[model samples]
Target: MRLSIPIQSHYYERKRIMRLFEAKNLTKKYDKTVLDHLDFSINEGEVVGVIGVSGCGKSTLARLVSGIEKPSSGSLLYQGKPVDFKKGRKDIQLILQNSIESFSPRMKIRVFLYEPYHYFYHLHKNEALDCIKKILKQVGMDESCLEKYPHELSGGQLQRIAIARALIIHPRLLICDEITSSLDHVVQREIIELLKKFVEKNHISILFISHDLSLVHEFCHQVLVLNNGKIIEKGTIQQLYKSENEVVQNLLKAAYLNS
Candidate 1:
C-alpha cells in the first residue's frame, strides 16, 4: 500500500488563519443545560446570526466562541487546531451586550482606544496615539471622543468605542452578543451598517447574537433559531422565510408583521 500526502501548489503557510467554530456534544449547564449537543460551523467571512427569545443560550454560545466560557463537554477548534484562549486571546474579541458595563467609567476614550495598540504593538506613546486617531476616524468617531469618559458619552458613542477596541487587534472573528440591543433604532442601524462595512472591507467573520428577529434578517446571511438551549432551526435568510418549523415561521411572521 502507498501512502501519499496531498501537496498544494499554492500554499502560503503564513496566510491569515481561517476562523472556525466546531462542537461535538458541546453543552453548557448553568442550573440546567443552557446548550445541548450543538454542532455548527461558521466559515470565515460569513455572518452567522443566532436569534431566539431571551435566555435561549444565544449569548452562551457567544461566550463559548469568544473563549469567555468553556463548554461543559466538547471540543472547539479555530483554524483546525484545538482552541486555546491564552494562545489566541487577541484574535477573537467579543463586544458585550451592555455598553454601560463594557467600558470603565474612569477610562477616557483615548485610553480605551489606544490601550490595545500599546499592549499589542509595544508602540511608543506617539505612535499609539497616531494609530488611535486613525482608528477612531475609521469607526466614525471624532477626535473629541478621545477626551470623554464612558459615563459622559451617549450609549451609541460608548458602543462605537467598544467596537473600536475590539477592532484594535484586527481580530479574525467578532462575536457581538446583542451589542445593539440598548441603542435606539437609528443608532442601531448606524452601528449595524458600520459592522457590515467592516466585514466587507476585511475578511472578519461575525456571530451576531440577538433576540430581534427583524434585525437579524436585515444583517445576517444565515440564522440559527435557538429555543430552550437547543437549536430548533438553522438556514439561510431565504430558507428561514420558507421554513415550515413553527418557531422560525412564527418569528419570521412576527418580524414581517411588525416591520
Candidate 2:
C-alpha cells in the first residue's frame, strides 16, 4: 500500500480548456490520514473517472470536492476560485450508490423531487411540480413515478429518480460515487447513456468514481489510478494499459480478473 510513483498525467499541461474543479495537495484525516496529499483537476464538460481499491479514499475525495467534507490541508478550487460552499452550494451536487437512502420513505416521489426547486428557486408546490415533471422527462421518467414511494420502486428506477432530482438543480459539477455499481448491467448502461445525453447539451462536468474499470475506460475522458491515497498514474484508458508502473499493472490485472 506504500507505493509512490511520480505524477505522469498530461492533464496538468493543458492551458486552453477551463478547469471545473481542481484539487492541489488535498489531504483528509480523522484518527488517521484517510487521504494523503493528492492533486487532480477535472475540466469543464469532462467526465473524469477515479478508480482504486476499497477504502482507498475514493468516496472521501468525492466528499471533499462536493464540499460535504473539508480537507485537513490543501485546497479545492471551483472555476479557478476557492470553493465557497456557503454562497454557492447549488453549483455542486453529489449522488451516491445507495439511491434509496437519499429519499424519504414518508414522501412520495413528487415530494422528494420538489425539494430542489423549493430550496433553490423558491417555487410554490404547483410551480415546483411543474418543473419536476419536466425534469423527470429528461431522466426518462413520467408522472406515474411521482406518486410512488421510494420503497415501491426498483433499484434502477429509484436511481434514475435520484439523478433527476440532482439534475433538476442544474449543478455545474456532479460527483457520482459508485452510482451504477449496484444495478444490473443493462440498467447501468441506461443510466450512463442518460448522463451522456445530458452532458451533450449542458456545460456540466462529472467526477465519476467507481471500481468498474471497464466502465471507467469506456465512459471517462481521462482516468486516474488512485492507490495509497495518491494518484500514481493517469491517462486515457488506452495509455494506462501500456503503463510500465507495476502498481497500475496489478490494479488493471485484478480488475480484469474480477470482471
Candidate-wise lDDT, in order: 0.80, 0.85
Clashes of 2: 0
Q: How many steric clashes between backbone atoms does each model show?
A: 0, 0
Runs in model 1 lying further than 4 Å from the true structure: 1-19
Name the TM-score of candidate 2.
0.92
In model 2, the runs with Cα more than 4 Å from the true position are 1-16
Q: Which pairs clash in the backbone of model 1?
A: none
lDDT of 1 by residue, 1-259 (tens): 1112212112224266454665567799888999998877776776788988777888789889888899898878887888889978888899987877977889888887878888888887788888888878888989898988888888898888899889989898899998998888889889988998887788688899877665676677667888888888887666777888897777777666765
Question: Which is the leading candidate under TM-score?
Answer: 2
User: Model 2, 132-200: lDDT tens per residue?
Assistant: 878888888878988999999999999999999889888988999999999988898799888877766
**Residue 97 CA displacement from its true place in model 2, Å:** 0.5
Instruction: Report how far off residue 168 is in candidate 2 (Å).
Output: 0.8
